[model samples]
Target: MQQLRISIPKPCTQNWADLSPAEKGRYCSSCQKEVIDFRGWTADELQDWFANSNGRVCGRLSQKQLDYFKPKEVRHEGWSFSAKVLLASSLALLTSSKVYSNTFAKSDSAIHQNTNEKGSKIKEEAKPSDSLIIIKGIITAKEDKLPLPDVSIFLKNSSVSGSTGDNGRFTLQVKATPGQKLLLEFKCLGYATKELEITPESVAQELELEMAFSDEGLTMGAVVVSYRRYPLHKRIWNFIKSPFVKHR
Candidate 1:
């Protein structure tokens, strides 16, 4: 009979959790030189290491260690019916709110624009028509044809009055209807008073008035002396008694 010899593999003495990091490193160097210690590795790190090592057993790992370091499959479930309904409702509410806000803003802008247009229209309708006529003229001396200042121009039946400026120009604005007759009176201290009658057609053109010097100084003095006496009867008697008293 022939003698036979056989070699048997040794049972693993240290598990992944049983050995400290330094002891595992020494053991890996002595036994499996290519094995890496994956005791403190995260799931992602283990998975990456396993993938890089082509799923080769790196070292002796217990079942607990394997389970702890195994990468869990991420089972993503599609949106549930209730979740989809909630999302759709929220989106619809947000869209409706935005639409409502935009519509309200546009309506407010249109309302303001319409109100402004109506206000402008009302103002236009309420505006008054122009009825005033402007009368402008110049005063001058009749003899020398030179401009005269401080001449008074007044309307006969109206309170409108104006005086000539230094340039002998006068302006009067009065309200008058079409085809109405306007009476203007011009007077000065040493000049004879003059009157002018104008229609609207004539007022559209500028006017120039010449005034002649008057000799009413003596006549005015005689009139003043006649009124010196107060009573009406006495004034009349004195005027009769001394008609020539002023000449003397």
Candidate 2:
């Protein structure tokens, strides 16, 4: 199957949080369309969905996925509209560059230990398994190398999450194989968000994750998303409105 490479030269300004949830995606009452959230989708899944899609798609994606596609940006010196990447017979003209931090947005976080229903910390014995990945580490500030406390670390799509204690130490565990790679996010208030790729083999040694102090505010990588596939009419509409897109 051909690879799917999507680009969005124009970023949408509408806040997606207000949109109501639906079966497939969230409905944007303003644009009268459903915005699919493809935050944790695999590259093969993405390629399959785009291959079969028949209508216009407006969805969201991760910065990692963008890097994998490696969409090149070009400027037309005398054009009034912007340019975007278009797949041959499979155009994905969307506001894909609108940043959505999915990796750090995994919010079911608990610090140092697991808690029960009554909020009591649960201490369970961790047995090393071939299918388990334990990421134990100390989080620090990138500039001063001082250990940072209250840092939330979690897997991008999984429920496995943990935070650091006052000593800036944490142990996060997840279930995956040595071959499967997963995204890990480090997040803390007043610090720049950070991410890492972890595998069972790589988790053998302890980690020392670092984050930048948020001078202005917490910052994350831009994540482009699309809702659905676009048919010919929508493409024409986009062309008429922007009039600056170039495709192959």
Candidate 3:
């Protein structure tokens, strides 16, 4: 039972009613992000949402929801929404790279590790002891372990973004400096949106984006309709008279 308290200190200035409908919630053109509607979500679902999204999350919750889910601050040190990868050997290149993540800029600034002709790793020239880090990973369905193709991944509040290929492999190149936090957002239809937070001291390591299916996307249980059982004679009589019976 993970209870979370949500407070929107800086509420969005955009009109909520004017926003267009989106898959998870509404799409706000101003922010270029989907505004999640948590009003209908259960407490469990809300807890899971906050748990997965390390630290900050932007969503709408009612006053009643606020009161019910009160004051339990969830904080995770080091890596937030971190993933483990099967290919541990490939992550060696990043081990040497001192990755300091604030926020990264658009695609132009997106940088990755350089490689030689024989696939050997090469270091990119840095500006006065700056570290250029390359983050790569594969996205897969957590349930079936199947590759999820075309899943969109991007750094929050930036135009820099990429998608998983047919093999579910994705590589993002970004230049980050020390002393700030960089938040990465992964989104796909039918699955819950996942966010990963990177810090200044944290090493650029395996960024396996394994996402789980949303509660709504999961197979629902059969609807149990409770009804009074009738005797065979009464049932037959009701069936016989059903066609003749008319509402006033």
Q: What TM-score would every model get versus the actual structure? A: 0.36, 0.36, 0.35
Highest lDDT model number: 2
Per-residue CA lDDT of candidate 3, range 1-248, in tens? 11245555555656555677677656877777777766546666765566556445456655455555545333343233233332454475465343432333332254432224224422334345455666688899786577878788998886778889989988877667775577989987557889998864564566676887564422121111122344444445566777565311
Q: Tens digit of lDDT per residue, candidate 2, span 1-248?
A: 12346654454556554567665546777767777766535676876677567756666555565566654343343322323223422343233322333433443343223345335422333324437567788998676576777788878988889999878899977787557888989887556789998778888899888887554421122223343434444456767876875421
In model 2, state the lDDT of residue 73.
Answer: 47
Q: Whole-model lDDT, candidate 3?
A: 0.60
Quote the lDDT for 105 in model 1.
Answer: 81
Candidate 2 Cα RMSD (Å): 21.5
Per-residue CA lDDT of model 1 for 7-122, tens digit only, reads 11232433332233453332333354433433334555544444444322434332344444333343344347547778999999999999989799889999999999999999
Off by over 4 Å in 3: 1-131, 200-203, 215-248
How far residue 125's Cα lies from its native spot in candidate 1, in Å, is: 21
TM-score of 1: 0.36
RMSD of 3: 25.6
